[model samples]
Target: MSSSIENEYFCDGLTEEIINALAKIKELSVISRASSFYFKNKKTTTKEIIEKLGVATFIGGSVRLSKKKMRITVHMIDTVNDFLFWSETFDRDLEDIFKVQDEISLFIAEKLREYIGHIEIEDKLVEPLNLSINTYREYLKGRYYLMKFDYESTLKSIKIFEEIINEKPNFPNPYLDINQGYAYLGTMGLLPADEAFQIAQPYLKRALELDLSSPRSQLNLSWIECWQNWDLQKAYEHANNALEIQSTDEVYLTISSYLTVEGKLGPAQNYINKALELDPFSAINHHYKGYIYYLQQDYKKAIQFLQKSLTFNSVLPFPPIYIGQSLLLSGKFNEALEYFDGLKGVSLKDLTKLGGKTMSYAFLGDVSKCHIGIRELETYLNTELMGKALTFLVLTNVLLGNYEEAIDYVELAYKNKLPIILLFNTEPILKPIKNHKRFKKIMIQAISDNSNYTPIKRYRHSLLHTEDISKYVKEMEQVMMENKLYLNPNLSLKDLASYIELPTNYVSQLLNQGVNKNFSEYVNTFRLNEFKERVIFDENKNVTIMSIAYDSGFNSKTVFNTFFKKKEGITPNTYLKIKRRN
Candidate 1:
């Protein structure tokens, strides 16, 4: 079910009610409101909707509200065949809104069950809710505001939930909604963590007292336990209790995140997969899945999922941020820079874009530009974004080869318990100093403090072993030479691994240990040789340096010139002049 066009609050409420009604049928696997609502006010294709949600069929409609009347138009789509299986239009007075929603839900459920050959159902699947229309409207408004997820909107939601609680103090749903609103405010960095949690506890306790069976309340409590109290066992217990009542996408995602922080990648993957199965259309779900893959050092798969997440919602900063990081980790430095550059000027307020640009510039060897970004990010340091800003500064320093300063910031992040530091073991930006004694000590301390902490094992084997380094290096070089892989400006570690029939981690290990160089350094060595022989000393001097750089697999003229000067102690043009004069 989807939201209505005219009265988004009412439409969203109706859609959620229908979904909840359908979920009561034990045999049906209903998509959650979080996933289904992702399509609200957006134009999406049927095929895309089906593929993203993993739904066999879907119901879409629009709602129209007049002074005293309501109209709803609905169509059921058979996703497998792209067929409109049923269509209906309803006209009713505003007072009959609940009746209309209930009728519509039951009709759809009956038709769907019949279509699926479950014709002998004994009892009604949907139960009627006992609530006043006015109170229900207030709850809908609260939900509508909560879904916005911004600071002002969350505050507005809280206000509305407070109003509902005042009018009907025993209503558990509004209390739960208030708890969730504060939880989101804190989790999303919209408010001070202490304040948000303080404000949330009373609401949550009231909700649990009102309705102990409510899974959402338990899930909200679980988040508070994990993030605020750092009580992993209590968090797990609450999460499991929520799942016992109802296995919701949000609950699964919550548990998955806890597991992810613990470094239990296998269990994390399983739970996140369950979340995806329940809410496949959710951009957040896909983003996290990509992040998980990134931690696993599966760059190609991570890129694929992150890119898909963008297709679902292009405005999200996470997908682009991680996509650029993944590209950088794969040694596509020029490509990574380009990706970050494309995000510039889209929104000045997006810190993730700034962070990405800062890291990309640093990795591309533009120390000056990187510093400019670092200074810009520093302005956010005292605000609600202190943790994120500090973390980006740490990454920037790492890129600048300032390992000591980076470690200092890492220590600060650890002290602050910044959520970003949770990725200490897997963040590709920290790869340069990952093996350093200081960084390892920080990681060990972090792991020791959290019972859920699981050491990231993606690069464990390659880092621990160094046997047959020469053989691996030889294999890598042979594959590169045979394929002339160095000639491809967009070549990446993953691509090289594919050609060599080796894992990316293995290839990275060979370059770092066996050859005492990184992927970009090794590839640029061949490219520089190619450029000098084929272009600089070529009899035809008419060819341009930039053209030659491109032909020799150097994607950016700036990068080529900088690298060439660094290696040869002269600019490319100067080297050419000196060679010709000699």
Candidate 2:
């Protein structure tokens, strides 16, 4: 059953109560709150919801509350044939809200049982809650703030939950919610892990003491065990207990992340798929799906899912960050640079944003800018944000061809037990040094105690490899020379390969092996040579410098200047002035 309520402090909580009540029917497979609430205010057809959620029937409704009265209107729809099976509107006094909820839940359950075949209604399914309306209102407000999913909002929710706990010391819901808020803050790098987990421990324990059957309490305990104590068995036990109670999308995604770090890709993929199925429109689920594909080195699918995530929530910086990383790895350096440049004015100032800029500049051969970002990241080394900052620094160094320093940072991250190091074995950004003895040794140590330890394998072959390197090299040079392909500002490796009737991988290999340069460097070498001949040798005496650059395949003047300075140790104008003086 999916429902929304208006003009009430505890609208979401009331909706969740109805869904949970219906889920108690042992015969019915209920759509979880995460899946149902995903369509709260969105305009969607019943068929679309059914197909996405895999439900045969759905309940939709809203509640309106006045000062002293409440009205709830609900409708049941059979998605198979788009028929309204049953519906009703009920008016009741504010004091009878709990009774109204019970009536609605039982009425729907009985009607559904009659329609689909009779099933016995158990006594345990309708346990009475002994909560006051004021306490419930506060609990709902806490839930509302928690759903915002930001560090500040989470902190606010924790404050609200703490107030509730003070007023009603026996309330288990607020205790569980406070633990979840702390977990979110710690996991997202917004708070120190030690500080967050230390504060959360008592709340978690209290919640379980009050309500031993609460799945959320178990889930929160699992996170603390896995991340803080590193107790895999206990963590698994708690996670399993939570899943047995309810297999919600958040729980599935959490388990997927745990499996990913353990190098259990197959099982992780299953959980991630389940998460997407349960919450298809969730940007976070899509982001994690792309991230899992990325860890598996499936760059094509990684970029596809990451792009889809951006379409859902462009305000999020992580999707674009992953997309840029995927393009850089696929040898589309120019495209990746363009994407990074487009994020110039975004408000996000986190390590992801800085890392994207650093890696893009490093790959594009802008060493000064890359180092600037590195220095900025170094400022966070002594601060509480060291884990996140250092992880990105490692990525930046890898792109800058500073493998030794990258390994040094990896060692530090490992020593600190940062969770980001869990991806060391499968992260493509660290692939250049995957075969390094030190890197392999560190990876072995990182997961040595875990049962699922696997050796990190080096990628022996390029994604685009050909046996006849010299043949492709000659063909590539001829195509560039005869067609003057470098004159096209928008030329890409795919375009060049299509023009020469060669495979993209073959062209990439020729550039990497025969020329000792990537696609971007190979193309820019020609452009720089053209610029030198035209400007330094006075081949274009009457043309402006910008026009000469534009004619020589450089799209942006700033990029042309930066590339020229990086290659020649001087800007284009300075180089020209020196040549003329000579």
Q: Which residue pairs in candidate 1 have backbone atoms (N, alpha carbon, C) closer than 3 angstroms, thus clashing? A: 262-452, 262-453, 262-454
Assess candidate 1 and give its TM-score to the true structure.
0.64
Per-residue lDDT of 28-147 in model 1, one digit per residue for the tens?
667988788777657988688778778887888877777678888888876764656567799888777777777888777655643342222224434444667667777888887776
- Cα-based TM-score, every candidate: 0.64, 0.70
For 1-582, candidate 2 gives per-residue lDDT tens digits of 223343455666667777777765545567766667777668997788888788787888887777777778888876764567567898888677677777788777755653453333443444455677777787788887887666666789999999888888987888889888887666655665556777888998898999888777778887876676565556677777776665567777878877877768888888888777757777778888998988887889999898887666565546777788888888888888778777754543346667677888888898998899899989988776676688779998988889999999999877776666666667878889999999988877665455442212212354444557767777888889899999998776668879878655455556666777766567778998998888865557677888999989987665677668779998777887788898
